[model samples]
Target: MQRTRHWILRRLSHLDLILLALVLLLLGISVAVVASASGQSPARISGHLVNVGLALSLMIVMANIPPHLLSKVGPVLYVAGVVLLVAVAVFGEIRNGSRRWLNLGVMAFQPSELLKLAVPLMLAWYFQRNESGLRGKHFLIGGALLAVPFVLILRQPDLGTALMIGASGFYLLFFAGLPWKIILGGGVLAGASLPVLWGFLHDYQRERVLTLLDPASDPLGAGYHIIQSTIAIGSGGLFGKGWSQGTQSQLDFIPERTTDFVFAVFGEEFGYVGTILLVALYLSIVARGLVIAARAPTLFGRLMAATLSLNLFTYVFVNMGMVSGILPVVGVPLPLMSYGGTALVTLLLGMGILMSVATHRQLNKT
Candidate 1:
């Protein structure tokens, strides 16, 4: 009986209980907010539950796998992700004026989701392989690798996902010892080229920026998202309108409330105080991730963990900024709090990698 119990224990994931519990709590919050956003639609709520369930299961499976094995898989995953991005550019479906999804017969999905993990892992693996003697050209090669996917995703016109991917790669590169001179130079160059880049933006994308600057310019058009979301948030005050009692959400004034703008629903229903707690929860999760990154024994583990943690931070920051009328709405979801399968799965997969990094080190020590 003891032997059988031991075998069962061996098969279980070495999950960081704190991380697991925090994410689960966040997921729970997501369901409640999604319920309010969807007006308690049973189908939407049930479908969201299915997605969360499936994503959590994947997270557990990924957590059990060691970082070394993930390192070996990084290059292959990166290659596949790039190939799919190219395929998406060539034969992807056009939805909401963006060619981001590829039809796989069984189901259609955005290929760019793969890059959320592949980019960081690939760069970490690359730097680790060349760790003994790194040089400028190695950074160049890594930049080139990062650029290919970025350009491909950019061509798909998904500026949000593309920029997020770019940010993740930048995080990985920075951790892999990318020099600050290049970072500064690149920033200056990017600023100088803003006029040139503006021409490349889609009309709607350009309008989003314009509306962000002055939401009243097109109150019923491009400016609607910011105007409505801010109203919802402000109306909530200290304790919020009380869950489903939010006027903006219940009346359907907010767009994309279940996805990109879910944070608005949260802000309205929970208020400033609620949002504070939410931010604290998010910070707690990031704090745990930083601990894991700091403690990981290998460069690959450390870089990957740090990148994932910061990427999650990016999600929270960008989404809040968008909803609060501070930044242009880039359609970034609010991490585990938003309802979506692809992004949710990608986030969970990254957390799984973090768990592997956290636990496998202890396993080796034992």
Candidate 2:
């Protein structure tokens, strides 16, 4: 028992306790909500448990790695990710009108998910190399680097992932001290191109934006999701209706209740107090991530850690906003709280990188 205890303590000596605790809490809540929302279906419950285990394992493995090694491998991973994405575009499987996955003999996977990590890694590597000479030209080069994968993803018509990936890259550039004038100018240009963008959007995408602006316009059609989700949240009141007792979810009024809109089920079952707690938990995780980023020893580690922290914040903000009808429905999942294997693994992998940064710094100090 003494040996076992000592082994465990040494293994977790450099781990971020606050972040890990928050992750476990979120996972627990996810399992509970999924069980309730899914009517405690054995398959769903077991599947989620498996995903949580796998994600935790990935996190642990990543945490043990050093950030210096990750930075060295950044370019290789980025190139591989881009190649896989191109392969996806060329001969990917089409499911539900989108070509976002590649089919292996045993299973299918989405290459776009890899970009979420690779993009930031690659950008961090580049910025670190040119740390003393960052300027407008460098920013332009970074923009071009970002644009290649962004265009391919946009063609896949997965607006959500593309936007998130783009945001990830841009976040790094911004943190690298891209000028405010350049940011303002780019923002103006983007706004001016709205009409061009509107023309490029698929009808369904446009409808979602419209529905976000006013869901009542087509209450039974394009607006159904937002309407039902809001009703479910509103019905929860101060303390919620109780677990497995939410009418909107139980009776099938809520769409995508197990995935993108899972938070609605949580809100309906847990109410205002529960919602507050969930939000606070997410915020606490983000805060810890930022703290880690602020303390990272190297420029690459700092950029990568901070970008991941902000990216996580963006996911929670966008998902909750869409579900609450404050933003357009964009198919963003509710982080670890949502029921999906790929996303959970990817997110935990990023968190693992953060832990690696912390661990590497500690080792250097010793």
Candidate 3:
């Protein structure tokens, strides 16, 4: 028993307890909400459980790896991710009107998911190398690094995932001391280019944006999702409709309840106070990640940890906003809570990187 305990302790020494606790709580809540959202489907609930286990296992594995080793691997991952993305674009399966998934004979997955990690890793590696001679040119090179994959994913027409990749890369550049003038200029440039960008959006994409401005205009058509989701959330009141008793969710009014709109189900079942507590829980996890980033012993570790942490915030914010009718609906899933093996794995993998950053100093001591 003593040796068994020793082995377990040593193996898990890299985990940050606070972050783990928060993540567990989030995952536990996810299981319950997924049950409700999925209408007590045993298959879906079991699959979610399997995903949770797989995600946690990967998180542990990543936690045990040293930050220095990850720094070295970042560029390789980035290159490979880009190559896979090209393969996906050229010879990928078309699902739901987008060519995002690559079929590798025996298995298939989205390469954009890998870019969620690779983009930041690549930027961190680049910035760290240019630490001493940081200049406008270096940021330009960083932007170029980001634009390649961004264009590829956007061409896949998955604006949601593409935006996420862009956000992660931007966060990395921001942390690397990107100038405020440059940021402001870029914002202006983007805003000015909106007319051009609008012409490029697909019919469905354009409808989503229009629907956000006013869902009632097309209540049964383009606005159906937001309309139903907002109703579900509003009907929850203070204490909620009570667990699986949510009418909108249980009656299947809310679309994609198990994934993108899981928050709506949670709100309906948990209520106003429950939603507040849930947000607090999410905030706590973000806080812990930021703490780890602040304490990371290396520049690469700091940038990687901070960017990944903020990236989590972006996911929550976008999903909630989309479900609440405040933003255009997109395919972004609620982190750790959405029901997908791929999404769960990629998200927890980032958390694992957080643990790796948090525990690096301790690892070096031994």
Q: Root-mean-square deviation of each candidate, in angstroms?
A: 1.5, 1.7, 1.4
Q: What is the C-alpha lDDT of each candidate?
A: 0.92, 0.91, 0.92
User: In model 3, what lDDT does residue 14 have?
Assistant: 85
lDDT of 1 by residue, 1-366 (tens): 999998657646578889999999999999999999999999999999999999988998899898889999999999999999989888999998889999889999888999989999899999989988989999999999999999999888889988999999999999889999999999999999999999989898999998999999999988898999999999999999898999999999999999999999999999999999999999999999999999998889999999999999998999999999999988899999788898899999998999999989965454
What lDDT tens digits, residue by residue, belong to model 3 across residues 63-85? 88888888888899999999998
Candidate 3: give the clashing pairs. none
lDDT of 3 at 45: 97
Clashes of each: 0, 0, 0
Full candidate order by TM-score, most accurate first: 3, 1, 2
Give the per-residue Cα lDDT of candidate 3 at 306: 92
Model 2 root-mean-square deviation: 1.7
Between which residue pairs do clashes occur in model 1? none
TM-score per candidate, chains pooled: 0.97, 0.96, 0.97
Give candidate 2's total backbone clashes: 0
